[model samples]
Each structure stands twice: as C-alpha cells, then as structure tokens.
Target: MKSSKPIAGRYLGYREADRAAPYARFFNPELAPLAPHVCAALDRGGVPDILLPDIDQATTNLFGGEAVLEDGFVLTSDGGMRVSVRSAMPSVTPAMVDWWFGWHGDAASKYKLWHPQAHVHVGWRETPPAGASGRVLYVGQTSIVDEYIGSDLIRGAIRFVPPATLGFTDKSLDDDQQATIICAQIGLGDAPIDIGYLAHHVRAVPGGSEMRSRFWMGGRHVAGRNLIGGMAAVVAKRVLSVTESDARALLVHCAQEMPHLASFLPELFGEFKDAE
Candidate 1:
C-alpha cells in the first residue's frame, strides 16, 4: 500500500485554510478550470431557495444560536470528488440528521441521479435502528463504464457513528453540542478502492447554532495507487460536473416535496429560482 500523504495533501487542503470562520474555497488548483462547468450545470438544475424566513431562528431553536452556511467542493485524495453546500438547520436536531442519514425511504427519488430507475439495495449490520450503519448497493452500476449506463454509484457501506470513532472527544463541549461521524468504504466486487469520511459538527452559539462538515477521501488500493489515483481524478471531474446539477436539483426537490425541510432554506435569490 502506498502512503496517503500526497493524496491527503491534495484533498485535505482545507486544513490550511483560516479555521477561525467558516470558509468556502476550492482545494485542488488543477480542478479549478471545471468550476464554470460545475456552476453552469448547477444552474440548469434549478437551485432551491436556501434562504427562508426565520431560518436563523429555526437553527437557533434546534442547534443554539445564529446559523453559518458555506458552499464548495473538494477532490478526494484518491480521485473522487464531492461538492457540498452546508448550513445550520436550527429547526432540525442532530437526532433528525441522524435519522435522515439512515433512512432509505424514497432516497432514490429524493436525490438527483443519472439513472432514476436504478435499484438501490441497503443492508444493516451491528447497528442501532435510529442511528444506522450499513452497506448500500446501487444494484446495476459498479464500475466506471457502468456509470455511463446510469451513475458511478460506489459499492460501499455507509455508517453513522459517534464522534469518538474518529477520536473527537472534548470534555468542555455543551450537552446541546453534538457531532456525527459518517464513513464509507468504496469498492467493487470485494476489491476495495477508496474510503471517505465526513464529520458533521453541531454546536450552540450565544443566540443561535452552527453546523460544519469536513470531508476527506483516502485511496485503498494495495498496489498501483498512483495509476488508480490518476484514473480517479479523471472520473471525478466528469462525475462532479453532473453531480453539481444533481445537488441543485435535490435541494429544489426537497423544498417542493418535503415541506418540513423549509426551515433550512436561505432566502432564494431570483437567479437560483429561475435557473434554466
């Protein structure tokens, strides 16, 4: 196995950012050229109204004080890519987030997919019912080529575990402050490829609340890690370009279909609502 140092340096560049406040910036300079394409795709997906009335109040009600929102994308050390728009959902509790993460109900429809009809299979092992840990299969799509037939869905297991699993234990934290760790093991037909870890941190502020997510990816190939890394980067660009649109579509779908999630919306600018 190759050392993950180089990959980590490329993907986890956010660690060098100003951590004093929520920051939004791209990590991989090589991927900078794709930003316009990503934004354009997102525009076509019809962005939702993320800004809603009482959004700050709602975050305060659920998380603690004022809310913080940030948007950006990262190229994983192993070549995978993810674009995220995160904000504090004050009206939604950590338990709620945990539930949503575990729940597979209508998930296939809720999120944008290259293949809407693709079947999704989920299995749980050594996990609680409310806070889940399990494996999910995209059914027909496995390899990179298969992604064109539908989507390059990772054949992996997703687990929602305690922060301690990631070595995050702070005694001075408040009771209302909470954190959730989600990890994924990516592979194909028993052969591991990559791993992803995401940390969801929620804390109470003086008058409201804040939630932040940190995501990282690591290559898992036992050999030819560099070759796999190159291929992954190429695939990441293609996948991320379309996925950005998918994300925007997802937010819009949630706002329209799941009214309960409205509390997290930022006031929608005309451009987002009227996207072509």
Candidate 2:
C-alpha cells in the first residue's frame, strides 16, 4: 500500500530552507476565483465529446509510447459513473500536471525523472439533484527516480471538489454554465503531503476546452520530499512557459487523428496565433 524504500537520492544535497513556509494556502486563493471564470467560459461553449479513438491516440502520444490502458467500467448505486484506467508508461516524467493534461514536449521531457506503472481510478456523479456535490476522484502511482533516489514507488491520490462548496454561486451564470473548480491534494499512499496542492481550472472554449493548472509548493517534510519537490518545481515552470504551444500540439494531434475536429483547431490555438 505504501512505498517501502528509503529516501536516498543525490538531489537531497541542497540545504533545507531557513524557514518552513505554509502549505495548501498558496494555491487555494488564486485558484478559488479563477475556477468560476473557467467554468463559465466552458459553459458558454461546450465540453468536447471526444471519441474513444481520439482519446486512445492522444494518450499514447502524450506519453511518447510504452503505455497501454485496460478497459473497465462500473456504476455506483447513486447513478454515478466510475471508470478505471490502468496505464504503464516506462518513460514518465515528474511533471504531474502536464502529464495529467496530456502535455508532452521538449520542455516537459526535460523534467523526466522516472517511469511509473500507474493505475488510475476515477469516480464521478452528476449534479442538479438539489444540494448535490460535483466531484471526482483520481488515484494513481507516483515515483521519481535518479542516481540518488534510485527507484522508490509512491502512491498518489487527488480529489476534485465542487466550486459551490467553496462559496461559489451559480447566480448570473449562463444557462449552460458547466464551469467547475477543482481542488486536489497530492498524497503519498494514505499519508498526505503538505508540500503543495494542485489547482486546475478547465473551461470550454469556442472549439475545444482550455485548462490552466497552478501547483503551489510551499514547505513540507516527508520521506524524499525535498528531492521530489525540487524536481516538480523545475518541471512545472518549464511546462507553464510553453503551455500554449503544448495545447496546440495536443489539439493538432487530435485533429490529425479525427479530421472532423480539424475546424476547431484554429479556435483552440487562437491564443497562440501571433506566436505561430
């Protein structure tokens, strides 16, 4: 259930910060406001109903091969949907957000640390049941390997909470308002880490959807925490700088596979029009 290996990596040579900083607080504020905006924007447009073929190829290209997903689905008694996808990516990097959003580029690759055999369990149910909560759960394997840390596997879990729970109201929201906020905590097996949190706001645009993720790493101490934390920061910064380009690449790949979605390509890459 938990990683048994000791935290012995060469990257642990750096001195600890003079003062430990506060965790969780860093990401909550910024992401709180942005979640509503993103959800509203997405509502105005629409969530893309991507085909299974598109998803399969996009996932394959995202990891750069050496990955496969198992098929399985389950239904909860509350009429919710539960999907389990097991994947094995031998060349996975430590850029958790980029990996989660399917971003794989030179910048993303620079943060490569280790490969992981991950099994993700996703569960979600619909809303509008009156006072119902819109949430989802994602649990998978976590690991970072280098000459110093070797190869110790860690279990990670993220829970997505509804924006309404955070005091967000649907008043003035568009009739198709499908916007939502996601607050996720990264944990090692059953033990939660205070080093940082993952906040992502996803919205539907004209042609496709847009997702912005902010990872705030404060100060937390766990086994091999410092080493993994440092690597994550490096990777996060690199991915953030090239987010537009990464989004374009992902869309282009999807378009190439599904020609019908090509028309939305321009809209998806609109933000990067000048860059091109």
Candidate 3:
C-alpha cells in the first residue's frame, strides 16, 4: 500500500558513476526486444484461469510434467492472485541464474540492470558469509527490493529458499546442468509478513535454459514474519485485497523482466562471477 515515490527517493541515493562503474557498459535503460512468444503472451491476456488453492497442484505440475499454464494470471477463489510466465533463456545457464540472484541484491545499480526501467533498489537484510557465492548466498537469504509491477511501483522482501524445501525432488534437482529451481517466499518490505510464494524453474535444453515461473499470492502462503505477524496473517486476506488488475500487472511485469534479464545475465555473470 506504500507509494514508490518515497521508496524511489530512498534508493536513488547511489551515485550513477559509482554504481555503473563496475558493470559500466551493461547498464542500459532501454529494454531488449521481448521474445516473440513473450509478445504473443502479452496479447493473449484474458480472465483469471487458475484458482489460488490450485497453487499446490500447479506447483506440482511444473515440477516434473508438462506445464499447465505458461503465461497467465487468475483471481483466486480466496481473493488472491496466481500468475504464471515462461521465458526462454537462449544462452543463460542455471549457474548464472543462481549467481545473479545472489549478486543483484547487494546494490541498487546492480538490481537495476535486471530491469532498468522497473527496478529501483535492492538491499540485503544480512549478507551471506565472506566466501559465500552462487546458490550458497541465495538459498537462505532475503533481499528487499523496490520495483514497478506496471504503473504501480512496489516493494518486496524476496526470501530465497532451497528447492527441496519447496517440494522439488532429488531426481529433478540432482544435476545443475539439467535443472535449477529458485524458490522464494514473497514478503512485505516494512512488515515481517509473507504474502506469497514463487518458483522460477530453469530447465536446461539444448543451447540454453527455459524459466517457468509461478506465483501464488494472498492466500495459503500468507504468513507473518514472526509470531505476531503470523497472528495478523489470519485476517491478511480480508485486508490485503488482490485484484485482477494487480494480477495483470504482475503478468506483464514478469513477462517483460525475465526475458530481458535472460538476455544479458550470462554475460554479466561471466564478468562478475568472481567479484563481490
């Protein structure tokens, strides 16, 4: 419910020279052209197709079998929202995908590179150990981010977790070359309250990988960051009303940002994989 105006001002504190100094040429405000399938997805928008309670089944569906809905959104029966999006990462590797999640949270400028037009800031609550990197830094960490999901600029606490923790199997998760899943609990920036869950499944194909992302918001996943937050979560649904418009914006934002990030992530990771 907070406006992005003050949030924008808060993180706009970083100097462009200092922030872009490392990534230098990679910081681009203009977005790369979206993949053709992404373009078609934008045009295919319609009514909410999946229920929020169906999120468990939907999550199961994406785990092993063919996906149920690649790019879509729905207003759940429980007054929540469900969103799905698929991005074909032509040359991005699973390792790079994991690395980006760990690295981008350290700074606003680095976060902006993922979606220059939308991302405003990223700051970690507690950074991983001194030598930690890759999935090590991400799986047990939280990143507070401010970004636009359409016209609405929003702030989120993206808390990453292990694939196994989110129900991914050993078989499905065995080989990093085969697949890598990034799972998270989505929370509010100010309050210690989680409102949703998200999984971005990146499966290796011939040349690159594909990211299948699903989000369940404002329903069963809702929880307080602590005991009090947990108690408050009981009425979370009544107070936090998620609308069809919110769902649509979420779909559009994901559709645009994922592929855009995929375009440059591989190169960015290769360059900064060893740096802080």
Q: Each candidate's TM vs. the true structure?
A: 0.38, 0.27, 0.88
For model 1, the superposed segments whose C-alpha errors exceed 4 Å read 1-69, 76-84, 88-90, 102-119, 126-150, 171-194, 204-211, 218-276
- Lowest lDDT sum, 10 consecutive residues, model 2, at 23-32
RMSD of each: 17.0, 21.7, 2.7
For lDDT, the strongest prediction is: 3
Q: Let me know the TM-score candidate 2 reaches against the reference structure.
A: 0.27
Candidate 3's residue-wise lDDT over 1-276, tens digit each? 335565435543335564646785676667767666666765766544542225557556685465365777777767777887788888988878877888778878778777777788888988865445433377788889888877776778998988767777747568777788888989988777889889898888888998988888886677887998988778775777787778878877787788888878888878888887
Candidate 2 per-residue lDDT over residues 1-276, each given as its tens digit:
123443343222112331132211111111111223333432333222221112123323222345422222222222221121222111222122222322111111211211111111221212111111211122222322221112333334333434343333433213223333344444343333323344333334454443333332222211234566456544433332322222222222222212211222233323222221
Whole-model Cα lDDT of every candidate shown, in order: 0.33, 0.27, 0.75
Q: Which digits, one per residue and each the tens of the lDDT, describe model 1 over residues 1-276? A: 121112222221223332322211211112112234334434544222232212122223223455532334433343333333344454444434433344332223222121222223333434232211332322222221111112333334343444455555554233433543232323332232344444455554343334444343332221212576556644543443333433343332222222223232222211122221
Stretches of candidate 2 exceeding 4 Å from the true structure = 1-153, 164-178, 218-276
Model 2, C-alpha of 100: deviation from truth (Å): 12
Tell me how candidate 2 scores on lDDT: 0.27
